[model samples]
Target: MDTRERYAAYAERIAGVSPSYAAWARSLDDGVVSVLDEVPESKRQPELLFAVARRLGADPADPGALRALVQEARPALLGALTSATVQANDPRRLAPVVPLFAALAARVGRPLGLVDAGAAAGLCSIPDRVTLDYVVGARSEVVRMHTASVEPGLHLVAEASGAVPTPAAEPIEVRARVALDPNPIDLAGPGAFDRLVEAVPPEATDRTALMREAARATLAAPPVRIRGTLPGDLDRALEALPDDVVPVVLTTGTLVYVPGADRQRFVDRVRERGVHWIALERTGILSGVAATLPDDVDPADPDAFATASLDGVALAVSDPFGVCVRWLADPNL
Candidate 1:
C-alpha cells in the first residue's frame, strides 16, 4: 500500500484506541508524509512518526504543527524513527499468562526465573507483582489471581472466554527477573519513562495511567536487563537465569518485529532448553502454533487477535493488548 493507504488503515486500527491519531492520519495530506522522504521505507510507520512528533513537543493531529516540527527538527525525527524500538508496553497483556507461571512453578516445585524476551523495558515482567482480575466470557465469571497479601497498588482487568486456568493454590515465586532487549530502557529516569508513555495514543488516559502504574512497579525493582534480540540470543539469555529455578521465557507482542522466517527458530530455541515458553504474539505468527488452532477461530484478524501459546502449543486466542481472552487448551499440559 502507498503512504496514503497505510495511514488510512492505521486510522481504522486506532479509531478506538486514539481517535486523535485516527483524525491525524485521516486529515494529514500528502505534503505531511513527504517529510519522511529521507527516512527508510521500513521506518515510516504512522505510530513511529506520531510518537516522534509527540516526543518532540508537537501535536501530530495538527498537520501544520507536525509538519513544522519535522521541518525544524528533521535530524531528531530521523534519529528517533530510525533507532527507536518503541512498542506497546501493555502490562495488562499478562492477565492471561500470569496464572500459567504459578502452574509451572507448582509443577516444577521450584521458583521461576523469568526472562522477558523482546521486552521493552521489562514492563510486563512484573505480572507477579500486580493483582489481575479476569472476567471470563460474556456471563462475566470473575477470576482473581492475588500474587501478594499486601494491598496491590496496581490492578488490571481483562475479559476472558473459555474456562479460566486455575493458578496454583500458592502464590507465584519469581526468584529471578531478567529481560532481553536490543536497547533496555531504564524506567528509573524521567526521560525514558516520558518517551514510553508519550508513545501511547495521546488521548487514552486510561491506558496511560495503566502504563504509569506498571512503570512504577518496574522501577521499584528493575529486571536484570540484557542487550539482545530473539532466536540468535535466546541461549545467552537462558544461561543468565539461575540454575535452580524453572526458566520461563515470555514474548508478548514482540514476535511481529522478528523476521517472519525466524519466529519458529525462536520457538525451537525455547523448546531445546526445556524451558516454559509463554507467548502472546500476533495470530498466525508461528505457523506451527497456528496450524494447531481450530479453523473456526484461526482466521481472526492478526492485527486485533493473538495466539497465547505455551511450549509451542496454542492455548488461547487473546486480544493483542490483553483486553480479552479465549482459552483453547490447558497451558500447563
Candidate 2:
C-alpha cells in the first residue's frame, strides 16, 4: 500500500483500539505521515504519533491542540519519533495471561523461575505482585473469584468465557525473576520513565495508573534485566537462571518483531532445555501453536486479538491488549 493508504488503515485500527489517537492521526495531513515514511515500519505505530504529541504538551483529545503541534512543533515531533524505538510495553496486557500462568504453574507442580523474553522495562516480570479479580463462565452459571489474590496493592479485573482455570492451591513460587530486552528501560531514569508513560495512548488513564503502580512495585527491588538482542542472547539469558529453579520462559506479543525462522529456533531451544513455554502472542504468528487453535478462529482480523498457549497447547483467546479473556474448555494444562 502507498503511504497515504498505509496511514489510513492505521487510523482505522487506532479508531477501534484507541479513539483518541485515531482522531489525532486522522487530523494529520497525508504529507505529514509521508514525511515519516523514512521511519522503520516497526516504529510507525499510532502510539508514536500521540507520544510525540504528549511530549510536546499537546492534548490528543483536543484536535486544535494536536493540530497546532502538527503545524508548529514539526521539529520536536520528528526528533521524538526518530530518537527512540517504540516500546509498546504495558502491564495491562499481562492481566489476561495471569490466570494462564497460574494454571501452567500448577501443571508443572513446582516453583518457577520466570523469564520474560523481549521484556521492555521488565514490568511484566512481576505478575505475582498484582492482585487479580476474575469473573468467568456464562451469565447463568457465572463463577466469581472476588479477590483471587496474587500479591497486593493493585487489583485488576478480567472476564473469561467458559470455566475459569483454578489457580494453583499454592501460589506459584517465583524463585527467580529474569528479563531480557534489547534496550531495557531503566525505571529510575526520568527520561526512560517519561518515554514509557508516552508509549501508551494519552487517553488510557487506567493503563497509565497501572504502569505507575507496577513500576513502583518492580523498582522496590528491581529484577535483573539483561540488555541484549533476542535469539543471539537467548542462551546467555537462560544460563543466568538458577539451576534449581524450574525455568518458565514467557513471551507476550514479543515474537512479532522476530523473523519466523528465529521464532521457531527460539522455541526449539527453550524446549531442548526441557523448560515450559508460555506464549501470549499474536494469532498465527507461530506455526504449531496456531494449528492447535480451534478452527473458528480468525487470525487475520486485528481485533481477533491473540491466542494464549502453554507448552504448545492452546488455552485461551484474548483481546490484543488483554482487556478480555475467553478460557478454552479443558486446555490439557
Judged by lDDT against the true structure, how good is candidate 1? 0.76
lDDT over C-alpha atoms for residue 199 of model 2: 60
TM-score of structure candidate 2: 0.85
Clashing pairs in 2: none
Clashes of 2: 0
lDDT of 1 by residue, 198-315 (tens): 6788788898888888887787667988898888988888889878888899988888778766777887777777888878887876888888887778444633378877777777
* Candidate 1: Cα lDDT at 6: 74
Error of 1 at 134 (Å): 1.6
Position 298, candidate 2: lDDT: 80
Cα-based lDDT at residue 160, candidate 1: 68
Off by over 4 Å in 2: 1-17, 56-59, 62-83, 137-153, 300-303, 331-333
lDDT of 1 at 242: 79
lDDT of each: 0.76, 0.72
